[model samples]
Target: MNNKFGLSNEYTLAKVLQIKHYTRTLFSFKTTRPSKFRFKPGEFVMIGLILRGKFIFRAYSICSPTWHNALEFYSIKVPNGPFTSFLQKITTDSSIIIKTKSTGTLILDSLTPGKRLFLLCTGTGIAPFISIISDPETYIKYNEVIVVLTCRFSQELRYFNYKIKQLLKQPHIESHAKNKLRFYLSTTQEPYPYSGRITWLIKSGTLIADLNTYTLNKRDRFMICGSQQMILDVVNLLKSIGYIEGTINNPQDFVYEKAFVN
Candidate 1:
């Protein structure tokens, strides 16, 4: 049923716990999790604010791991954009509404068992992988987890790097993530040793050379999230290499979510 805010009962209110600004355009916020809420690591939930009795919201991939006490999201501030413009002004004293249900194809359950897991993302698409990498179950599911993140600058990568290091310090997760997690960072519009789109890097064999692993193994699994064009490029490349897209009902070798980026 609809509520006074013209929202369904599926939504619940939560106070913002903290907000971290990575750069002028990038930020992340944590909201108190509903005690009864439950979600897998890579899932996303709708979060928004209600104004003038109308709902203004967007689907955001959860950034923090499930083990964390609160729900976290990484977002890009779009000047004058409908939701984010307002979101950027919120403080810890403010509250946001979150949909109780969460869903996404990037969760571990969406792919079949594999020898290795590859998470390829660009920009804010790294949110889901951030959660995936912090989860201990990820280490148990695959022999190794490879993350390829491409950004416009190095500062964005630093946020992700710090998150990983923090997770590595977590008692139950450190041992697992430390042993199995690996990262390859690239910047497109900035000066860096590894600078370029990840898809281009993969196609050019530069990614493989840097990682020292060439060719996709038959037992390798993939989860990609990025710009629509980036997703298309990676999907076509993976398909050419014999990887099959999958769904939760019938797990396959790969999956992708374009929700995070355009």
Candidate 2:
């Protein structure tokens, strides 16, 4: 199928390898990777399908690690979303289009070396971090890796919880993640052990208290992903503590990216 942008040569056709639905509004799928496709962990690429003869593409963060044989994506099913409404219906062997180039700011290379790495995310924002944490380089670079995931309901966190467990069981990754990895889960609308937005937790010092470790400082690095409002709140909180924004050219204390364009 030809892309609506008329750049067919810039797109690669890939077949869906597997699909798993976690909830009515959430699902994940894996697709065959092109031999020439190469992307760093925590990057995103455009993906879509032809609908009524017109191609519809959306930016999606790749959830699988760079070493993985197939590309994986975790997505939300927006009721009337242009791409998701049809994307949620795709099955194994379904044909989809993946843009040749992948790029994003939420990458390990964008941050300076630090002792501890914190990955803060909400909703599908956990996608990029999934790839980051799964990569062996993450564990080798930092002494501690903490992933804070917050969602409206407990069910929304199931997929990540399961994925982390599976990743821990892997022979190659198990050693690095065993004592170094920490997963913190919280829910806002639903009752959970940890409840409330992460910004509030940081403000109240409860997050630091619960972790029972050193406070945020130059020795620590942070990566954030989520909604615009959430990102704004977290960024403000980090800035107040003297954390600076980072990029590929300017390595700093923290880096972030939007889970989806709003």
For candidate 1, which ten residues in a row score worst on lDDT? 1-10
Q: For candidate 2, lDDT tens digit of each residue in 1-262?
A: 4444465677988899999999999999999998789999899999978898787888899999898889999999998988898899998858799998899989898899999999999999999999998988999999999999999999999899889888988889988787999988889998888988999888888788888877777889999999889998898889988999998999999998954535
lDDT of the structure predicted as candidate 2: 0.89
Clashing pairs in 1: none
Per-residue lDDT for 4 in model 2? 43
lDDT of 2 at 231: 91
Q: What TM-score would candidate 2 get against the native?
A: 0.95
The residue ranges of model 2 lying beyond 4 angstroms of the native Cα positions read: 1-7, 258-262
TM-score for predicted model 1 compared with the true structure: 0.95
lDDT by residue for model 1 (80-194), tens: 8888988988899999999998888787887989989989998888999899988888999998899999999998886788787788788898778776788899999889988
CA-lDDT, candidates in order = 0.87, 0.89
Superposed by TM-score, candidate 1 places the C-alpha of residue 205 at a distance from the truth, in angstroms, of 1.1
